[model samples]
Structures are given as structure tokens and as C-alpha cells.
Target: MIESMTPEQESNKPKRQFNNLVNNPVMEDYSLRYAPQSFRKWSEYAVATSALGGIAYLADFAIGASIFVTYGFASGVWAVILAAVVIFLTGIPIAYYSAKYNIDMDLLTRGAGFGYLGSTITSIIYASFTFIFFALEGSIMAQGINVYFGLPLPWAYLICSLLIIPLVVFGMTLLSKLQVWTQPIWLVLLVAPFLAILFKDPGAYGAWTHFTGNAKGGASVNFLSIGLGAGVALSLIAQIGEQVDYLRFMPEKTEKNSGKWWTAVISAGPGWVILGALKQLGGGFLAFYIFGALGATLAVEPIQQLIKGFGVLIPAPFIALTIATVFVFLSQVKINVTNAYSGSLSWSNFFSRMLHWHPGRVVWLFLNVGISLLLMEFGVFGFLNTVLGFYSNVAIAWIGAVVADLVINKPLLKLSPSYIEFKRAHLYTINPVGFGSMFIASVLSIIAFFGVLGSTAQAFSPFLAIVLAFVLSPIIAILTKGKYYVARPDALGHSAEEGDTHALNCVTCTDDYETPDMTYCPYHEGDICSLCCTLEKNCHDMCKKPGVIEVSMRK
Candidate 1:
């Protein structure tokens, strides 16, 4: 029996759909999938380099410097080390998950316990992570532009915000290429200033290490100082999201490539702190040297301090300015592009899950920039130290919860979901496990920060956030018996709640995915991969209405 062709089929038979290279794994950079085996063509070195490049922002220097100035050398140094250790340990599991599964951080959060709608708060947290830092890096860039071009502060903000747009529009593809190309140049400039300073006085950093200024306790290593310093340093804990964006592209580990895979993951993941710690120490050292050499009255910002530090190495003043300008610009460019790239991905995940609408990453790209611009206009720099100190608590809380899931809950009680259950059709709306826990942590920490819990508690807000979020997630998961975390088996794959090999197609990008990543999106009225399902605007979550545990609870 012959099947008759429908009107839609008859009209479209002659049309050739452009892959737009859409299905071409390289161009799209696995934007919609879990970096299927067919993709991940880059070498281990390239992947790690690309990943490392994302952390090249000048904020590390700025943060380190500010901590030094406010907390003194002992407090600042201790804080950097403590924060680095926290970030590195937490980073290990996150990097492993992203690299092993080839999924982005948003998808990872869903599988960990946030579920469909639940994971979204993490997206906002992550998006806020990006923009807050974006404003920071942009502020540094704007400061440089203002110094060099004599531009108005607002105009500098505009240029700093606008310059990175072209680079971030194509997302990871352009970023990977840009990062790869600039690696050597960035590396050279990063070291040149330090090398010159060292050459000028071999004993400079040595003396700087013991230098202390302004703090009432001096370098006596007081407990209050260390706690505050740690809180300040730990504020950058959210940087893991940016790392996962690149880790998603790591080639699937096989016997042949296992060593390289491990190497890449290590170098790009926790290894980010190697540079971060160094920069912090370097910034502290620079502040000491600059204050000593140029006198304490100069009152320069950290970025400007670095510029001047580099400028001295060039000897000829104008050429020194040019070199210093280029170094700062390149450093900001490298990091700001990453800030914008991660921001777009996060905003895309956030709004898509909440509103079920994704205009495109490019749209959120502008939104991210716009937010940073607003922060600049509001003069966020004035409160930078207080803000970072306060933010560290929430950041630590969020990352700590994720770390707890990865470490204790996943193994001890088997409470963690066995595989990442990211698809919309297969999970609850709000797990209450991650959502409820993080919300409680953030709320409590914020109150403590405002001194409702008193000055001692206020100083330890970051510690409170980390300890509370970590402790509560497992308690909630166990009390609830991990029921809200998953309502049904993730996919038609296995005996356990692990994913298997039922293949399906996306609605927008129209790519096939393993059953684990596919969802029945009502907007597309078909089975679409989670990424495409995420990108579609009109769904209104009709598919999950009956399934979401939150709705059931209200009913």
C-alpha cells in the first residue's frame, strides 16, 4: 500500500535545509547536545588552553589587591589560599561531571537535584556570577580607556561593554579560536611586567611578602582578619560555571586518550587556581612594591597599578604607556569575552527555563552587557569590597551544595540522582532538594550579613553559607527520601535510574539525542533534545504540568 503525501510534505519536498552547519558539530560546538563522540575533535592541549583562557580576567588582580589593601598582607594572603583550596576542591567534581558527560553546567545542575524549574535558580545565580564579574572586568577595561583616551566614565563603560560583543556573538566557537590565538601573547604580557620588576630588584617580592599596612592588628594573623579574608577570597567560587563551558567539549575518554583526557581536565579545571593564586600573590606583591617604590600616596587602582608596574619596564614613558595599555586591554579582552560568553549561556538557560522563551544567546548577550552597564552607571565600584565580601557567602553556599551532592550524597546514601536527569519531560519542576536548600542558605546568609545575626556572624557569613547549604541538602534529600528529585525513570534505558540509548530528535535544531537528553516539549509538539527544548519559547511547560511535584503539592 502506498502512503499519500500530505500538503506540508508536498510543498516542502523541493527545499534543501541548510545544515547552516547546524548539524555540523564543530560550528555549533555542541550547543544543543552533550558533545557527542563525533564532536570533541580538539586535542587535549587545545581544550585545556581554551579552558584556561577563560580565567584570564583582571578581576583576580583587582580582587587580590583590594583584599591586600583592606585586610593587610597576612589577611589577604591567607584568604587567597583558603579560597583557592575551596574553589579547587569544589571544582574537581564539577569538572569531572562536565567532562565525563559532555554537558554544560545548567544540565548538570538539573541532574544533580534542581530538576527542570529547580535548576533555573542556579542559572540566575550563575548568570549573576557572570554579569557581576563582567561589570568588574569591564570596569577595569573602562578605567584603562578613561586613562588612555580621556573618555568620560560613561563613554568608557560603553566602549568596554560594546567591544566584546562581536567576539561573544558566535559564543564558544569564536571564543575558542580567539583564546587559542591570543594565548602566547597574553602569556608574554602577563609575565613581562613581573619579570621586569624582579630584574629591577631581585629582593622586591621577598620584602613585599612580609609587608603590612593600615590594619589595626598589623600582620599578627588574627582570627577575625583571616575569616574576613577567606570570605573575600571565596567570593569567586562561582567561577566553576565558566570552566564547565569548556569542559563540556572535552573528548570522551577512551583507553587510547585517557591520559590526555585526565590531563586536560586537570589543567583546565582545578588548575585555574594555580594562575588565580599566583595572580593574587602577584597582585599583593605588586601593591607592596608599588606602594614602596612609588610611595603610598599614589592611590592607584589595581589595574592601573599593574599598568604602571608594566609601564616602568618599558623605560620610554610613551612606549611604556602603549605597552601597558596593550597588556591591560588584552588581559581584559581575554577575560571579558569569557565573562560575556558564560553570561549569555547562563541567561539563555535561566530565561528559557523560567519563561520558556529563548530568543537566542545573542539576545541574552546584549542583556548581560546591559546589566553590566547598569551596574557601572550605578557606580558599583564604590562598593566593590563590601559587595565581594558579601557575595562570597552566597557563592560559597551554592558551590558547597553542589559539592556536597557530588561527594557525600551521591555515594554514601545513593541519594544523588545516578545520572544527570536534565530533560524537561522526565523530572519535577522544583526538587526542593537544591532549590529549597539554596534559597534557605542565601536568605539566612543575607540576614547574617546585614548583622541580624550580629557582627561575629556577619564576618563569617561565607562560612555560614557554605556550612548551611552543604549540611542542609543531604538532610532534605534524606528526609524527603530523594522522592521529589525524580518522579520517574530518566529514560527507557536501564535497570537503575541511569541513562541509556533510546535515540530522539530535537524540534528546532533537529538533532538526535540519547533518550536521557530528549524531552517532549509541548511548544514544538514533538520530542526535542533538552537544549532545543530549552531554546523554544512557546512551550509554557505544558508537558510537565501533570508531572511537576511542585504543582502536585499545591493541588
Candidate 2:
């Protein structure tokens, strides 16, 4: 019996039973699948625009305003510049890898060393990224509502939070079109008022340039304040997850389109930060202008404050109120939709990975919105600076680990997997590499945020998170010897060395997925589609020869 076994069989390597699950293209979307050439469909321009569209959150405006009030325009300016630089530099590698390979952030994390189970924790973090920002953006919308219709902030919060459920339920297809359509209108509304104001009063620019408002530290350029402000803003760094959420649709790269592909990826991936920074600067400027005109300091209502700025453009009181409300509504709509979309995907990924059962992304949309609603009702926006300031630590840690894996660990030590391995059946439950890096960075950064570090360092905790994560990832990967990357021999499907692009099929759902999405599912005793595999809850992964990372770790 043994003698008859061929080498492939003699090795006792597991073969998938439900091949249809892995091949289904419609259900999976390469969520937990390998990104094959065929699945990467959208053009470069589409991906970039989709990514840039999501940055339309009003949090940037509020954040810039807060920084301007707390520090001066100079300090706020510096912080925005610094955060943008860091975001762009880190985004380059992440965007390049995800689009080049056509995997989502969750999938990328698997190959980056989070392993199968290990990546679950990151899922929560990533999910939080969506919901947290959703709350922020929703709150902004609520503020607009209160100003426009005299609605209570709480009711406004509920309205704003609940509205996205319908929009996101349709998923990427609707989202892409929505972004394309709204982008042009939002851009015009966003820029036109400011451009008009500048033309109307060229001297306003002069005043704005030199105007230093009520700075607690005496309005002088304080490096610590600047760094701290930047740290809070840097919380948005993990926003790349939202970007990659769309970029998985990017068209395949080839000799004919390689340059265009890379350019699109960068613009979509990290290039979003450039526009975000500009928007943030405008927010700061607007906040500054409002404060100057009011001849007062410290306004809790950003909308109320912003309304004053809009008054400078439109002479009529009622018309100006309407315009300001419209601007805020547009900004919030652009961002909250993205927030809901990304959150739903992240929540779907998280629970399915944990419970092995997926109801659908649409279900998670409600969950994500529910979480945002709670945060909104809890009045998290009241403590806006505090929440973002604390969150920046964790966000930085997560993004830092990701950047380290993509830019530093993968290239420097060769510990990174040759190709992205995102299928649940293909990776260890958890790998110490990404997890350890994130843990260490988060812990240290939290300490810094809490003032364990000195004042300046505390304000600049995000930078510290970046440094620590960047330093720790390669060391852990080298120490782990890349053992935990894959749980078993059969886990690695298709040779990446053959080429970067390939096609795959799902066993369940009977559709074609990317090679990355295709995985042998032991639960159904067949190759499972990424979506079913993601939603699967029964088998408990019986394919790894019974003693891989789980056993290794317990020992």
C-alpha cells in the first residue's frame, strides 16, 4: 500500500475536498484569497480615485481646528506636514505590495506574518479603524444636522450613523460609483467657497498667514505641541486599510501597464495622505479664520465655528447657513460611507475568522454602524482630541507593524513569505512576527501616550510607535526563523516563484477567485471559496497534521 503511493501522496499532504469553494469569484472577492491576475479588474485611475474619495471625512477639519486652537497655525501646520510625510513614506510599500499582489489588508497581513489565527487580532484592530472613524465622521454629520435643522446632537448622531447601512449593504460595486459621482461635487463645494473667500479678501490670506490664535503655550512654536498634534492626526495612518479595501479591484500589472499600475497603487495607497493633509491644512485655516472673525476663543461646536467662516463668503445669513450645512454634509457623506464600508468588511472578516461563520458583510454593516452609534451617543466626540490622541498610539502601532513587515522585515531578512498567503487554511493561527511587533509597539506607545515618556516624547508617541515597530519586526521574524508563517506543507498553494500572477477557483459557491483566495478547506473536505471559508465555523482546521503552531505554542 505504501509502495503504491506517489511522491505527492506519499508525503501525506492534504488535498482539498470542496474545490468549488475556492474557485468562486463572486462571493469571495479575494477577501481571504490570493489575488490572481484575473480578479484584479479596475483600472489604476479607478483605484486611486476610490481611495482619495474616502479621505473626505470632516475629522480632518475638526482635528486641524483643534490643533490650531491649542497650538498656533505654525504648530498645526508643522504637525500636518509631519504626519503626511510619515503616512506617505509608509504607505508606498504597503500600497505597492497590496495592489501588485491584489490582496486586501487582511490578506496581506496573513503573508506579512500574522498567520491564520494570529491575524484575527489584527482584524479587530482593523475593524476598530473603520468604526472609530465612522463614529468621528458620523459625529461631524450630526453637528451639521444640529446646525441645519436645530436637531439634537444625539438624534443627529443616530440619523447620520444609521444612514450608511443602506449605502454599504451593496458593497464595492455601489461604493465605487458613489465615490466617483460624489467626488466631483464634493470637491467643487469644498474648494469653491475657500477660493471665493480668498479672492474676495486677498488680505485675509495675509492675516491668516501671520495669525496665531490662543495658544496655551504662549503661541510660540512649540515642538512638543506640534508633535502631539501630529500624533493625534496620525491616528488616521491605518486608513490605508480602507484604501486597500478598494484597491483589491485594481487591474493586473503587466509590462504594458506596469508603470501606470504602480503609479495608481501609490496614489491610492499612500497618496491619499497628500490630499488628506491638504484638507487638514484647509480645516486649520478655516478654523483659524472663524476664530478671528468671532473675536473669541474656544468653541466646542466646530459647525457653529465653521458657520461663521462661511458667513464671510455669502452675505446672506440664511444662504450662508445652508451652504455651510451642505459642505459639512458632503464631507461627512464622503467619509462615513467609506467608514461603514470598511468597517463592515473588517467586522465580517473578524467574526468569520473567529467563529468560522459568516452571515454576510451586510450584517456587519449594521454592527459597525451600531458601534459608531454607541460611540456617538456616548458623546465620544465631546472628547474628540482625547479620543484621537489616545487612539493614535494604537493606530500607529498597527500601521507601524504593517509597514515594518512590508518595507523592513520582508526585504531586509527574507523572512517574509514569497507570495501573499491569506486563506485561513494556509497559515498558522498566529505568528509571533507581526503580533509580537504590534504588541510591543502598542504597549510602549500607550505608555508614552499616558505620559510615562517625557513630555515631548509623549506628544510624539506616534513617531515612537513607528520607530519601535520598525525596529522590532525584523528581529522577531529572524528569531522565529519564519517557521510559524505557514502551518503545513500543503498550506502553500501554487508557486509564487512561477510568477506574481495566477488564476484560481473556489470549491464552494462554484466561482473563480484569485490564487490568493483559493484555499483547500478541510472543513467541507474540499477546496472552499474564500467567503465560505471565511464564514465557516465547523471543522476547526483539521488539515495541519494535528501539531503545528498551536501545539508548538502550548508546549
Candidate 3:
């Protein structure tokens, strides 16, 4: 079998499928697939504008308020800062790789040591991030609708979920326009209430700082409380995956545009945390102010927080209510479009691997929205802290494993390959280095979160996940000798060694693909695009021997 193949045998393979780009115009967004360099036609500034605009979400406000209300001002502030730093640091490498490789988080995970199928788990994790946030954001929108228009909560939930489908179904083309257009108003509305508080109540800042939360360490800066708060805030660490979904459309970096490229990558990538942290801080201050006016129960609610803040500027209850409602509605729309879009991409990747069907991203879009709608009806916002707290452990472990492979394993240990190879034909089914590390990290952190390790460890579960994943990735890489990184050398596939600018015709899809997205398909007897290869489950292990598939299938 090893000696059977010749150049003639390889070249004689027939094409299997036609490209479906005409039917799926929105497929340009390439959800469930790689964002190849050939398809990245947008300017850096355009892509950055779109990516940065996603951070306009009001969830930061709610998250900050929850932390401040639970842990008090000092601890809340410290947690926000600490979590931002960690999020920023971990986000940099992931962002850089996505933009540089022109692939979204799902594709990046595949090459980052998760292997082909191993990334399916991470994709589901990422999809959960999008929908959970979608449900949360949708609930926020429903609240605004209920407050202003007198709509039933259930109806509002359905409306909020439905409104985003039109905006997201067309993908980034319309989303970029929506984000760019709404950005100015969103910014003005976001800051207007804060500015009013600053001017009208100058002493509020001092009061906000001194006000301990309703927690046991009320008004004090407790380290344990900070740890817990940080853990909760770290749940947003998965938010980076969404950012990179847009950043993947960034123009390839070159000497001519290197500065602009770096600027876009940083600002749109980790720089999101800068704005996120500020929003959390602002949420803390607003929560404190709202607490004084509306009491603790209603203070953490963003609708109430904004209404109270705006109420200072407008004396009329109806006008203030309208302004706050509109602001919340707009903010929710901005973020939910992103949540839904990212969710579709994640779900596409996940189901494509598990079921071996490419149903187009739009199908998954509606599916994600439906799931989010269900969660909204269930009132996900009521248990936000618990959900995000538990989720942060798994999110961090997955991100930490990927980041460690990028920052530490590839560069320092040289145990793993330098370039990302995502095609199923080229990779093992499970690379123990990443899958193993993330599994161990998630298991330990979850147990610790349950207090099997102690209260201190319970509060620091996210931190533990990061440390364990970062440490174990390299350790496991060394132990496994990195043999699982690749099943066998696939010389026929486009790789890092090949120039990415060249276009190759995918034998399966019969469409032109850039080098990075093309892989050799033995069944088709030619180079096939990653999407086609992924969807072609019938091919089985024909491209490689049974032993290779056997190796990849083992833990």
C-alpha cells in the first residue's frame, strides 16, 4: 500500500462534488469552513471596525454589576482588572494565529493540536458560548421590550431571537453595515448616562468605591471575593473566539500593511478586553448609583441601571424609559447578531464533523437561534452567574490548551509543528497534547469547583484551568513525542511550506481554493477543499492505511 501510489494514480482521481457558492451567497463568510486568504477581500480597517463593534454589547455592564453587587466595589474592580489582563494575554496569540492564517477559531483549533475530530468538542464549546450569550443578550432585549412596549415576556423572547436571523443570515456583509452604522449611536448612548452622572453627581465615584458589596466582606477588598469575581469574569474569555471570527477576515499582513495589520489585530482582538474592562467598571459605578436609588434588588439589572442614570438627565419617567429601552434594544441587537453568527459557524463545524453533512451555515443559524430562544424562555438571565461560573472552567481549559500550543509548545518545546494543518487527511483524530491537557484541566477544575479540592480552589477554578492546561500541554507533548500531531506526512495537501497565494482546484467541490484550504482526497483522487473533505465521510480511511486511522482514534 505504501508503494502503490504514483503521480499518475493520484492525478487520475475524478472530481466528486460541485461548489455550492452560487446557492449560498453568504457562504463567502465561510462559516463551518476556513476563511482562506483568497476570500479575505475586506480591508483591515473594515474588518477591525466590524470586530471592535461586537464589544458594544451591554453584557459587560450586567457582568460588572453582578460582580460589584456580589463582591463589592474594591473586589469587583480588582477582579475585572485581573480578568482583563488574563483575557488580554491569552487572546493575543489566538487572535494573531487566526488573522495570520485567515481561519476562524474552529479551524484554528483544529491546527492548534486538537486535531480534526478533537476540535469538534471545542467547536461545541464555542457554539455554547455563542448561544448562552445569545440567550443572555436576548433576555436583556426582552426585558427592555417588556418595560417599554408592554409586550409579554415570552413573545418578546421570540421576537428578539427572530430579529437577528435576517441580520445574521446574510452573514458579515450586512452585519458589518449594521455594526458600523449603529456604532456612533451606541457610543453616544453608552457614555451619555455615565457623563451625566459624572457632571451631576461628582461624589458618586467616591461612594461607589467605598460601598462594599452585599457579600460577607461588604465594602472590603477581599481576595477570596476577588478570586470568585475573576472566575466569573473569565467566562468572557471565550468571547475572544467570536472576535476572531471577524478578525479572520482581516487582510493578510505584509510589509506595506504590517503596521495597520498589527493595529487591527490588537485592537479588534485583545483590545476588546480594554473596552470590556471599562464597561465592567462603568457597570460597577452604575450599579452602585442604581443601588442608592432603586435598592439592591433592581440595581444590577441593566435596564434599571440605565434608566436610573438617564433619569438624572431627563426628569420625565416616560422619556427616560423610552431612552433606556431603545439603548438596551440596540445594544442587544448588536451583540446578538454576533452571537448568532458565531454560533452558526461553531455549530456548522461541530455537526459537519459529527454527522459528516454540510447543510450550509444558514441552517445552523436558525438552529442556534432556536436553542437560544429556548434558553431565553427558560430565563437564562436569572442564573447568569451560575451558568457563566461553571462555563468559565471548560472555556479556559480549551483556550488554555490552544494558547499553550501556540505560545509555548510550538515555539519553545519544538515538539509540535509550527504551522497549522487543519485538513482531516493530514492530522490525527486526537492529539493527546491538546485534547489530553484540556480533558485533565477541565476535569480537575470542575471537581475543584465542586469543592472537592477546597473552597480556595473552588473560587480559583478558572485560574486552575489555565495553569493546568498551560503546564500539561507541553508536558504531554514531550511524553507523546508529538507523534500524534500528524497521522502521516500529506505531501499532496497545501501546507505552510506551500505559498498560500496560489489557487488550487478542489477535486471534490470543483471550486478553486487557496493553498491552505486544499487537501489531498484519496477517494476523489485529487486535491479537495477542506469543507468537501470534511463532509465526505464515505471516504473513510482510504487516503491513509487502517493503522493510521487506528492511531488517530485512540486516546
Candidate 4:
């Protein structure tokens, strides 16, 4: 018969010594485990505002301008609206699940159907989103620097890249304060250009409605144009991952705080797209307003757009340029901090699972920023449309698969487990349901995007990814009977309830964690934390093997 290990045996095993960066809760921020209730002490408003602050990025402006320049007013505007609707709808379930479970997108993905190792691929995809957009945002900042300070693009790129590192190193403890404090100033600058246009140049709006840059159909709403435009806009679907990075820190909900909790989740969660869509439209209008003066190539640049807007309000050219540069700098810092922060989390998840060792989240922060710096040096902004358009296909498919598992499989079909099981000991290495569906959908969509299925199919390729992933996830779950989700039952046999804040001390790490992060390790014959379970190389998953003796938690 199986029996619990004695304390003497547990103490005889070696204890892991994490570096100071990983050991400090303020800096570590539970990058690889559940956000226990004790750590989620921030108010709902504070968390929501910090999450919302990440949307200060100017990529929406660039995307809007790019689409409108390529496809015309009617199709571009409609595409922005369409993409926002889809993003908002899909974001709802993901945000709710992440907030309720107190897990980041990576942890949630592991349980949502991708399983333990299956999420590694999605981690790369998500990390790609961070760096790709980081480079894009950093490029915009470089452009402002080049225009105003007369700095070379290379130097500007270095400055922009290095500036975010200090801000992000401390994780949420510092980030929450930074984001909340700067939000007001960022908001004012965000709307300054539009407000200037409304009062100083009202006729620009009329001209914007009629402007058509390179579109063959002029201002007409062509179906192909709408499809292609929406594809680029939808590349941002993975942004929900960054939002939930903060949402995971949400305080536990209760009858008293229920209203504030839901409000924070919805507003800071999917509600981000509402502002994002507006920014896109605003970007399109600004691009149109300045096209005559700056021509096509330079008009889409946010710095140029803001300069022109500020020029209208402030008659002095020098003052206008100074303010515009300041605004651009502020915006980039706000969003790039988030990009670097989220990228570190994603890279941590990827490397820890792959190598069975984690240096720390802070180590990966430099890696993420360094990759973005390289891209900025090479001028990724020049190929903006091509880059984002192609990326949307794969991103939407991954998000679609995760959403299907969250919304359809768990509740309606009752195929997946009701509560998330992210701990490695209780989950299989891979589950075919989400991983398979996403893979198939991404491959087919990429093929279509490359015009293998002809022009119309190519234009609508992202839609193909979304439909196929959503439809296939439930079907695959039913076919597999959901056996791949959990490798073994919880050894403690405790209820997988969200509100259970009871803490347990891991014998290996010698640290106290909430019950959800603890699991029985048959190899060590003791309870282990999720981070320790992930880093254990010797166990070889002995606890999960069939006919292996069950190890119970010590009383």
C-alpha cells in the first residue's frame, strides 16, 4: 500500500537555491505559477488601469493608416470595426477564465487543452507577438527621435530598446505603479491630435471620408479589401495575453466586490479593443489629413501625424515638434514596458518547460528586448502590412483554439475539466484537442494566405483559421473523450475550487504556496510546488506513470 513520506526523508533530499531575482516575490511576480490570493492585493481599479495602460502603443495608428492607405476609406473603416467585434467577443471568455483562475495565458493554455508541453509552441507564438510589436512600437519611437532630435535611426533604436529594461525588471510591483501614474498624461496626449483636428481643422474629417490612397476601387467597400484589411487588424488578437498577464493579478471576487471585479475584468479585458478600434480609425483619419503635405510614405507615421495635429493647435513649429516628440516617447515607453514584460513571461514559460531549468524572468527580459532591438535596427516598420497580415493567420488560429476549449468544450460539451489543471504532475505532455486543431488551422490558413487557394481565399485566410479552430477543438475533444487533459488525479484529493486560499509548504523549495500550486511528487516522496515540478529533471514524471505507487500528502 502507498504511504506518505516522513519529514526526515523530505529533508534529506536536496533543496533548490533560486537566484535572488527569482526568490524575490516582488520581482518574480509568480511568472510560472498561480497568482495566490495573498499576492493579488491590488484593487480592481488599479489592476484594470495598469492593464489598460498597455494599450497606449501607437501600432493601432500605424495599422489603421496602413490599411486605409492600401484599401480606401469604406473598406478600411469597416475592417477595423469587424476585427474589433471578433477580438472583443473572443477576448471575453479568455479574460474571465484567466482572472477567475489567477493564471497567465501560458498557464491557462496548458489546462485549456494544449496540455503541458503542447503550450510551448503557443508560447513561441505569443513571444513573437511581443517582440514583433515591440520592434514596431520602438520603430515609431525611433522615427520621432529621428525627426525631432536629428538622431540617427540606429542610435534612436538603441535608446528606445534600453529605456524599457529598468521599468520592466521589477515586474508588476513596479509596473503597476508606473502604468497607473503615467496613464493620465498618456491619455491626454493620445487624444490631443484628434481634439486639435476637431477645433482647428474640422474640414479634415470630410476630406478623410473621401480620401483613397492606392486602392484600385477608390472609396468603394470591396469585399477583398475588407477581408485583407481585417486580417492585418486581427493580428492583435494575441494582445489579450498581455492584458491577462495583469488580469491574473486580479483580487479574488466575492459577493461584496463582485461588481467591481466583473467591471474590471470586462473593461480591462475585452474592452481594450474598443479603444484600440477607435485608435485605428483615428490613425486612418490622421493619415488621410496629412497625405497631401507629407505624401503617402511619410503620412502614416504617428510622429508626423501628431506634428501636423500639434502644428494646427500650436502655431510655433518648434513647440509643435517638441510636444509631438514628447508624446511619441511617452506612448512607446508605456507600451514597450508591457511588451517586454509579457515577452519575459512567455519566454520564461517556454524555456523552463523545454530545458527543465529557468534562469529567471529578468534574464529573459533582456533577450526579448534584444531581439526587438535587432528588428528595429533592420527596419521592420518598412514592411508593416506584409508582416502583420501574414502573422494574423497563425495568431487567430491559436487564440481560436484556446477560446473554443474555454467556451464550448468545458461548459457546454463537458469534455474538458471544469477547473483548470495547470500543474505538470496532473497534466499530460500534450493534448491533441487544442494543439491539433491549432496546428491544422494555422497550416491551412498560411497556405491560403500565400494564395494556394486563390485570391479570394487568400484575402479571407484568417477567417478560415478562426472557423476551423473553433469547430475542430470541440470535435477533437469529443473524439478523444478528453483523456489527454489530466494525466493523474490530484493526490491531495481536495476540491479544485477557485476560492480555496489554503496554503501548503513545498518540501523541495521549502516555500509556502497556495494549495493549487502544490502536488505530490512520488520520486521525492513529498509535496512539490509547480515551479519545482517544472524544473525537476530527475523525476521523469514517475508520479504520473501507471502502476507507480501513489504518494499521499503528509498530514
Best by lDDT: 4
Whose TM-score is greatest here? Answer: 4
Which scores better on lDDT, 1 or 2?
1
Clashes (candidate 4):
0
* Per-residue alpha-carbon lDDT of candidate 1 for residues 1-555, written as tens digits (9 for 90 to 100): 123446796455331132443444443455434655545577778888988998888778777777776678877788888878878988998898888877888888887767788877788888888888888888877887777778998989988889999887776667888889998998888888899888887887777667775567877666777777777778788888888888887876779989889988987988898899898777767777677556543323555676667766877767776777777788888988888878887877787676755455666788998998899878777677788888887777778777778777777868877556666666788887777778788889889888898877887788888888889989989998888766554323431234354566655555566655665543343456766656545444555554442333233
- Per-prediction TM-score, please? 0.88, 0.89, 0.94, 0.97
lDDT of each: 0.74, 0.74, 0.85, 0.92
- The lDDT ranking, best first, is 4, 3, 1, 2
Is candidate 1 or 4 superior in TM-score? 4
Task: Give, for candidate 2, the lowest lDDT window spanning 10 residues.
Answer: 14-23
Error of 3 at 476 (Å): 0.3
Between candidates 2 and 3, the one scoring higher on TM-score is: 3
Clashing pairs in 4: none
lDDT by residue (tens digit), candidate 2, 1-555: 012335665355433343342233343344444555754566788767877888887787777777777777778789889999998888887787777677778878877867877777888888887888888788888888887899998899988977777776666667777887889888876776578778887786667666577777665678998888898789888898888888877886789988888888888788888878887877777777777555433343556655766777778989888888887887788788888877777776787777765555666778888988999898787787788888888777777777888776677677776666666666788888888888898888889888987887788888888888878888888898878886665443454434534445555556555444555654443455666665655445665656443333332
Candidate 4, 475-524: lDDT as tens digits: 99999999999998887765355456688888787889988888888776
The lDDT, on a scale of 0 to 1, for candidate 3 is 0.85
Q: Please state every model's RMSD to the true fold in angstroms.
A: 5.3, 5.2, 3.8, 1.9
